[model samples]
Target: MASALRRARAGEGPVLAWPLACGSTVAERTRAVDFAQGVLRVEVPDVGWRKELQSFAPQYLAVINRYVGESVKRIEFILAGQQLADRADKNGRSTRV
Candidate 1:
């Protein structure tokens, strides 16, 4: 099901559009989790980053929309806590900030 979903929306996902929208510098400090119902969920390192990025939502929306086919209407910035990062690190997953 997951693979099918990915296949169906392969080129139209906001997750893929994020890096291009924010650029490498910002992208390196964040992770685009998913997009659904016009909302794109992005994980930031902490509150400072979340607040900083949230302020740029409108602009991000514009760029994201262009690549996502105007499907993302809102950007939701969530915190990527140290606990989460630690877990990812323990699991050998990238806990990039």
Candidate 2:
């Protein structure tokens, strides 16, 4: 299966590793929402936070994977509201943004 395809929504290991992996500074600004397959979905305050952290995905993955043992292959940094929008979209609800 493609790494991007998700058959599951959450994984305990990654959620737990997320905080420690990213550290206190980032952990305060971001949330470890869930793990969809190998992708860890993280919620950030806004686009700036998303864009900035996303650039360090590799470094974040290194730390996260250390605790999760490479179970996490990708990090998806999304806006806090984006998570809700994505859910609404999946439910056939129209979202403005």
Candidate 3:
């Protein structure tokens, strides 16, 4: 879970957009996304989103840091569907999205 202090410091859009665009609910988005040591890892929905967001990363970073009043050095975007499939296969489960 995301620390409430961090959430409060980071404004709504800056905090919510990352996970929401990645297919997580606003509340769950904050909780599920890995945030540690000034880095946030989000599971993006697709390659298109990743490509687009990659271009806008600097802008996004400014907004996030400005709102949160702290520097987050990196934003890592993972392909969630593919990642889940890989995990499922390794665990002997169906690769169902």
Candidate 4:
């Protein structure tokens, strides 16, 4: 059961990371970001990082809009969850990942 759940989460992982792909340097450190039902949700690695990102929300949104080629009106940031945080740490320096 645990393994199955892990697999499911692993599959959904990429979907969550998609929006952070072209974001700012702060966004580059992001663990996950998802656009669902008109809301953009982001997960950063830590509180300090989250605060740093909040200061630059507008810039991050602009980058997201450019990468996605659409207007993203809102963004919410949080402390990264387990699976997502691990992925971020692994791929934090790779733009092509």
Give the best candidate by TM-score: 2
**Candidate 4 deviant stretches above 4 angstroms:** 1-28, 82-97
Write model 2 residue lDDT over 1-97, tens digit each, in one string: 2232223234767777777778899999899888877998999998898889988889988876665543788889888889888998999997785
Off by over 4 Å in 3: 1-32, 82-97
- Candidate 1: segments with Cα more than 4 A from true spot: 1-12, 81-97
TM-score of 1: 0.70
Residue-by-residue lDDT tens digits, candidate 4, 1-97: 2233234342343334344543456546775555554446777788897787778777766555544433457667777674455466688653334
Error of 4 at 97 (Å): 36
Over 1-97, each residue of candidate 1 has an lDDT whose tens digit, in order, gives 2243334464346787788789899999999887778878888989999889988999998876655544777888888765467568889997686
Q: Between candidates 3 and 4, which one is better according to TM-score?
A: 3
Give the Cα lDDT of each candidate: 0.77, 0.79, 0.56, 0.56
Name the 10 consecutive residues with the lowest summed lDDT in model 4.
1-10
Give the local distance difference test score of model 4. 0.56
Ranking according to TM-score, highest score first: 2, 1, 3, 4
Candidate topping lDDT: 2
CA lDDT of 75 in candidate 1? 87
For candidate 2, what is the lDDT?
0.79
Deviation (Å) of 12 in candidate 2:
1.0
